[model samples]
Target: MGLGTGQGLHYETAERLSAALASRTICSVELVESLLGRARTIDGKLRAFIALDGADALRQAVESDRRRERGAALGPLDGVAVSIKDNMSVRRWPMSCGSRMLDGYVSPYDCHVVERLRAAGAIIFGRTNMDEFAMGSSTENSAFFGTANPWDLGRVPGGSSGGSACAVAAGLAPLALGTDTGGSVRQPAAFCAAVGLKPTYGRVSRYGVTAFASSLDQVGPMGRSVWDVAALLGAIAGLDRRDSTSSPLAVPDYTVALGRERRWKIAVPREVFSDGLDGDVRDGLRRAVDFFAGAGCEILDVSMPAMDISIGAYYITATAEAFSNLSRFDGIRYGHRSKVAGTVGEVYAKSRGEGFGAEVKRRIMLGAFVLSGGYHEAYYGRAQRARVHISNGFGEIFRNCDFIATPTAPTVPFPVGAKTQDPLAMYLSDIYTVSVNLVGLPAISVCCGFSPQGLPMGLQLIAKPFHEEELLAAAAFFERNHDFCRRHPKIDQ
Candidate 1:
């Protein structure tokens, strides 16, 4: 139960591990063993990973060590153990996306991000659990199992990247990759009190990530510190021929932005903060604003009226896309097929019904309704127009400000199953974050403060498209003044 051999390495940030590996002071094999050992002991109750290929991870570690000894190490991530969300494919690993549909399916190829990590010599540690097909806000929708918050085991880790956040927060790994489709990465990061960055849509390639709202889905990085997050982002971000949406712009050296000071024009979206925000989160936002103002940054009140329609617009658009993307899972191509079905039609219908969880089914039905012939223009078309208005509003605001600041979520980590029976309540958890995805802007969540009950709250900073450097720099400035990221949750005590 104790950290065992991996005690010293458990809380080390990805940046620290990379340095240790590069200097030969610590080998990748040792670090991988320590982490794998810890995961074996702690992950049982946390339910963070759906798959942990320790043997393969150690083999990768040994290879990294050998390369380091030969002075041929790939890069900064050479020896770091990186946890991957179950939705991102890692060759030969199970990529269930916490769904029964792809339950036993092994990926034949690595995702674009995974390919980058492998090339960087990172030890592809494990596949973390997620909401089924990334449909739910809380991990309770995971068809297999739910991941618990490390700070409070009885509470839910926000999702659909709950397991990825829990892995980093619980010290199973110092770095992780999560997909953000309407706050999946940032919300969980906020709940777990970690740093998470969702890059500008198309900034990072999304070739092999299992589709979920294709237009909004993006691979992101999560870590214990701003530097670690920036580093991970740098490693995996670049142009990929396979992903048509990937930007051709050069990937900046994100680490250079760390520890730098610059006077920033920060916009506070008044509409977002006016109501429905929890007192603790509001307090955290106030403190964050005060800190930035004290640091000589200018804070201006701004308006994004269309943002008021973000939640409704996002669900409509995302669900419609999900419905289209998920149709391929119907027994014919790959994934779970119902044996009870005697005919092709029955196979398609029964397999999907049996394979999908409640949340997934609900979204699919809603999506079908919205995309139906008569309602398509009324619902889907309206949502698309709303998305354009929201994007334009963000565009106008960003032209004046360096970044936009707001609370990451309306509330802190909630008790597991508390909102499971009520989907609307669960959806509201991402009220503040959905807009960024809808607009294709870059955003990050950093721990701003904690509630009286000790749950963490996050301050979100959003930047213009392809401006992750500016976003990460601003987050690092705040991280420099706070120790929230340095402190690990005292779970199992």
Candidate 2:
């Protein structure tokens, strides 16, 4: 039996585990059994998952075995179990987005990605925890649950995709799915020491993922390796008719097209590498570029004049959209209703006040204020113009570079609650990642180094919209040729 057919199936990437199945070293039944066991036992400390569907997982695993025996067409990820963020809807499964407002809501149909994963023979083991309505930078805003960092239970995993990141990093699953709005996926991936991808907006369908910001949300994979992310991306991505926003381009064969799939020109914006980046993070970035350069790739220094405004502009646009998107959650419709309220308005006010956590309410109020008549021009409108400035700046840079690379974060994950009281401080943590969302580009964060505190730091890769293949190729080259991803905190370390 392979190592994966064991009592604990954590820390292995989906690609690695799937390869074991193809070789017939382990059966799908054994793998899912062990993986599912972890969800029942190990998940209690991590709080990564909100619900588990053991019967469904077993059903899928058995079906995969029957298919293999019959020599039927098996997808690349046949029978691998993965957790979906609570915000993503899967048929008959709870899709609460980590709030009391949706305590018992179940999706009537699968989201585009869910259908693809099921078609590919993957099993949905459970729904993972997340920020309420995908609204905050930490899982602390989840009204029903909190996801702790797998590395240290006291620290956060990051959010609103923290649940997915924790599941992947903690070995609750080989891979998981998450949505990135602002830096939701990347930030949490960095904090949890996992690999996370944010597809170019429209690269993946948003037809069923609970909407926080219509224009910025994208569904991407969370895993332990570059290829795991790429393979999952290959299965779930491409155009979708259900979502008018999905891109019309053909999905590239990312796994086959990786690693210098033709000579490449990678870029590093010197400004992004400037001061305030921790020493270890700076060194990691330097080493990542040098490794690629040595492998016959061009590493160029590029600049964008408006990157300075990306974080601020992103807040304006995302918050405004969030305000509008969240209004649909009134108690009368789909969410939790206030028990003590008599009038409908009181029901709404009481439900909203009690159902939402501090961060969700803060953003909703801030968003409402910005979109209000008097504040629109100075706040919302100015942010939109700044977005144009940032977008044009990225367009100009892409003219000279095939892709951009930077440390996924400016620093390692700080202690949980380190910035909870200060929203501005927390927002600043996304300085490097929010710009990618603003430009509607595909980007990824892979574990690149451990901080002095022994937590992880992620190195980020950015590619043009619909160019995810190029981004992961660079990441694969980096992963295979270096010791960057070989270290993680261990009990004996």
Candidate 3:
């Protein structure tokens, strides 16, 4: 790939590109236009973005260049191109969330993350596709179109942040933001060979993001390298008065983790190695552990018995929250209304039935069931208690070990339709990941190895709550020594 050309610069990380832009080696307009042009040429096959406004992006690029010319550049990220997930509100953009429900609904206000990115002069250029309502493990759940894995187009990219992962993997954009309710960001990043982070639940504000599971959802960054991901995270992370769930904790300079190395007490849970894990993924995790051991870290074996029941608990609690959160999208005020409705009840039923895709509908129905009078105590309440058990279990583990390590997913990217027919199998894809969300801890997925089939595999490192600096530093340590992070998907060929 050539550096000056759009396609060449496509693989450049946000950190490197920002340095180039700051030094005037290349103008922001040129970089933005270059990426936009690359998107125009290759996004057809990848379908990573649902909406792109070249005119607006170019205008912002010009403004960024002018600010830099006047020595008023906001920060290192000023003028760096970034993509936002469709679920996040970006003023005047179509916030479809990969569903027909809100097809033409334009956001009137920017989300907190969007506000931060814009404030730092980062060019918010496109809306990336996602699973409908961020409910699926694969992009195939998208109502519009499924994003293909850049490594092998016929296979799937894990979701609901699949589009963002694909965009970064295919060199369409250097950085993108995705929500991680239950491994949505990390799982897809693993499949796409990119870096994805899921911060502690209240670490990032959720003021304008479309709620999936309000208690669990967190907006995080994705990029080709840990440094790039950390940079993006630093730019968008801080306490926000707009979101009540946002923590009032101070934000740290994430980039300070760069070049820093330390030996960590990393725990390996046996529960993560269930029969469902593919052989290649198991090998990948093993190799990653060996790498860390070689770097002077102690590898400890621990058992998280709560993991066995986490999937059931997660689905129960998450679906219950989803049922409550999605109740606002009835056709009466906003979103798509069904013309076939003849009564108020019909309006609610038909509009939702028509608007939501199968996966979303399934989740909504399951959520409603779980929250129903008789089942609420039996399922939802039980799940909440199970979540407490999982959280406590992690608390005890963290006291002894600095972090927990596991394979990001049970397997690498599978064929597009491989598990869609079996919902239970699809749910298993996130078995190793959902518990972190349950406990509201910070975690990251970094490419560790590849499957025999050539698909990317990731090793996840999870830290204690509000310990993102340590998490990113550990990831950067591995990234600096490992060769996996340097290999880009050969999609152009």
Steric clash pairs (candidate 3): none
Ranked by lDDT, the better of candidates 1 and 3 is 3
Ranking by lDDT: 3, 1, 2
lDDT, residue 345, candidate 3? 98
Query: Which residue window of length 10 is worst by lDDT in model 3?
Result: 1-10
Off by over 4 Å in 1: 1-6
- Residues 276-356, candidate 2: write the lDDT tens digits: 687888987887788778878898888765767888898888889989998888888777888999998999899888787
Regions more than 4 Å wrong, model 3: 1-7
lDDT of 3 at 372: 92
Q: lDDT values of the candidates?
A: 0.90, 0.82, 0.91
Count of steric clashes across candidates, in order: 0, 1, 0
Per-candidate TM equals 0.98, 0.95, 0.98
Best by lDDT: 3
